[model samples]
Target: MANPVQFLSQVRDQAAKITWPTRREVVTTTIMVFIMATLAAIFFFLVDIAIRTGLTWLLGSVS
Candidate 1:
């Protein structure tokens, strides 16, 4: 088992090995995420509306 000092050293080494994204890359991906989220929300909303309408029509016709 590693002692506290060795564990901290290993953690520091791992942290240094990380390659952070550039500002432009971060911004581009953030925008893409927002666009994808908006599209998904719109698609789900349309699907929900279609299902609701179909169910309503079916129930109404049965009465």
Candidate 2:
């Protein structure tokens, strides 16, 4: 098993080698994710409403 101290040092070294994203890049990516999520939610909401309306009409016709 590796020693805890050695494992920690390895982790630190790996982290240091990573090239972190700039603030602008992070913000743009975040905005894109939000836009996609919002569009998905809107699409699902419309589908749900359509399904509910169809079911209600069918039930109403049967009664």
Best by lDDT: 1
Tens-place lDDT per residue, model 1, 1-63, is 999999999999999999999999999999999999999999999999999999999999999
Provide C-alpha RMSD values for all models, in order.
1.1, 1.6
Q: Judged by lDDT against the true structure, how good is candidate 1? A: 1.00
Clashing pairs in 1: none
Q: Write the per-residue lDDT of candidate 2 for residues 1-63, one digit (tens) a residue.
A: 789999999999999999989999999999999999999999999999999999999999999
Question: Largest TM-score belongs to which candidate?
Answer: 1
Candidate 2 backbone overlaps, count: 0
- List the global CA lDDT of all models: 1.00, 0.99
TM-score for each prediction?
A: 0.87, 0.79
